[model samples]
Target: MLLAIDTATQAVTVAVHDGATVVAEHSTSDARRHTELLAPSIRDTLRAAGLRPRDLSAIAVGVGPGPFTGLRVGVVTARTMGLALGVPVHGVCSLDALAHGVMADGERTRFLVATDARRKEVYWAAYDVTDQGVRRSDGPDVARAADLPAHLRGLPTAGRGPLLYPDALPHALPQLDVGAGALATFAMGALRRGEELLEPQPLYLRRPDAVPQSERKPVSTA
Candidate 1:
């Protein structure tokens, strides 16, 4: 069985893929509660699937272009659990998981996936939905919503961006968050094709909002 988890957006999603199909899943949209939500969601999903951590053959996670804290929660949990269970952990770009959901719906046209970057910017990617699967036709880049290329603006779009910047992505689809079930399915296909997956780490496209002080100022008696 494969366990998949994603906390790359406002949504915290987990799934249990029992080789043939996803037998159990859980999802909750709580931007402020990823740390609190992920663990129990994983445990419940596994229990619902009638499996345990030791039963998992592999762990797949969304190493995201997302908020530092939220991404850390999922990636760290995945890596820690993988270590304890003696299983390999694979990382998928959370954007690819969003795009995979679109392609799975039989979308045959090019589209965009843009999630909020929380600094009045977006983590966006362009994909071409193919018979085989979705391929990155353009970006996995970050930019201000209004500053995105005009050509990209006109593509059919997915993710929270449409909700966040309607004027930018006018043709947005209703799919808002990357589902872990889709992430699991994507990994399953990649493993079948003998494709290498990413290391289990956060894929922050930019530096975190918080940084260590370059130097501390001396406190002097005034």
Candidate 2:
């Protein structure tokens, strides 16, 4: 069995896959509540699947081009779970899951995966989708929403970025839902082929909002 987790955006998702099928999944979308929601969702999904942590053979996680805090929660949880179970942990690009969620097999399209990066910018990637799967063609770039259209014009798009910048992605397709199942599926396929998956590392594209104050520039009393 494979356990999948994706907290890359407002969406907090968890799933259990028995190699051939996804047994159960759970997800919630509340940007402010990732910490509070993710753990319980994992527990609930496992319960629904009638499985225990020991039943999971491996852990798959979505490493993101997402906000700093929300992305970290999923990666950390996945790593911790893998360590506890002594199982290998795999990381998939969260944007690839979003792209795969929408595109059909055997159909090819130039598509864009855009997720909210906040502060008027987007974390965006472009991919070419086919029966084989989504192949990233460009991007994973962060830019103001207004600039995206010029660079990513005329491609069908998805993710929370469009919700934040409607005009930037006018042809946006719906992809705001559970991504854990896809994350698991992607990982399972790779493992089956003996392909090495990405390390369970957070893929933050930019510096976080909070930065430490410069080493207290020696306060001097003259």
Candidate 3:
């Protein structure tokens, strides 16, 4: 069994993948409650699958180019569980999860994936469906939709960016956000193929929203 979690977008998704297929999953959309929702979702999904943490052969998580707070919650939780349970944890690109979600629906051979990056920008990647799987063709960068190359903006798109900026990403697909079910399925397949997945970490494409306050000079009363 494999456990997968993804919090790379507003959605928090947890799923259990038995050897052949995903057996159970919990998914919800909440921009502010990843920390709150993730743990319970994991517990509930495991219960639904009739499995324990120790029963898992491995763990997989989405390493995101998302906001720092939400992204960190996922990576940290996965690593902590992996440590405590003595199971290997692997990372998948959160965008790739979205791409896989799209491919599964319609098998679009080529397209784009973009998620909200706040600050009027987006975290975007282009993908090509290959014999092995979805291959990231370009991007995984941050920019406004209008500022992207024309080909990218015109590609059939997935994820929240199109919802937020419709005109710029007109060919939007129905699936948005990284689905943990898809994330797990991709990781398991890769492992079966002897492919190396990423280390469990956040793929923050830019600096975080919060930063240290500028140093202030001491006030001398003398």
Q: Candidate 3, 9: how far from true, in Å?
A: 0.3
Backbone clashes (count) for model 1: 0
Q: RMSD in angstroms, all models?
A: 1.1, 1.8, 1.1
All candidates in order of TM-score, best leading: 1, 3, 2
lDDT of each: 0.92, 0.84, 0.92
| TM-score, cand. 3 | 0.97
lDDT (Cα, tens digit) per residue for candidate 3, span 1-222: 999999989999999999799999999999899999999999999999998888988999999889899999999999999999999999999998888889888877789999999998999999998887789989789999889999899999999989999989999899988888899889999999999999998998888888987898899999
**Tens-digit per-residue lDDT, 62-158, candidate 2:** 9998889999999999999999999989988888777767663335568787888889888888998666667888878888877865758567777
Off by over 4 Å in 2: 104-108, 149-151, 220-222
Write candidate 1's Cα lDDT for 135-213 as tens digits: 8888788999889989999888889998999998899887899999999999998998999999998997899999999
TM-score of 2: 0.93
Greater lDDT among 2 and 3 belongs to 3
Evaluated at residue 196, the lDDT of candidate 3 is: 97
Candidate with the larger TM-score of 1 and 3: 1
Using lDDT as the measure, name the better of candidate 1 and candidate 2: 1
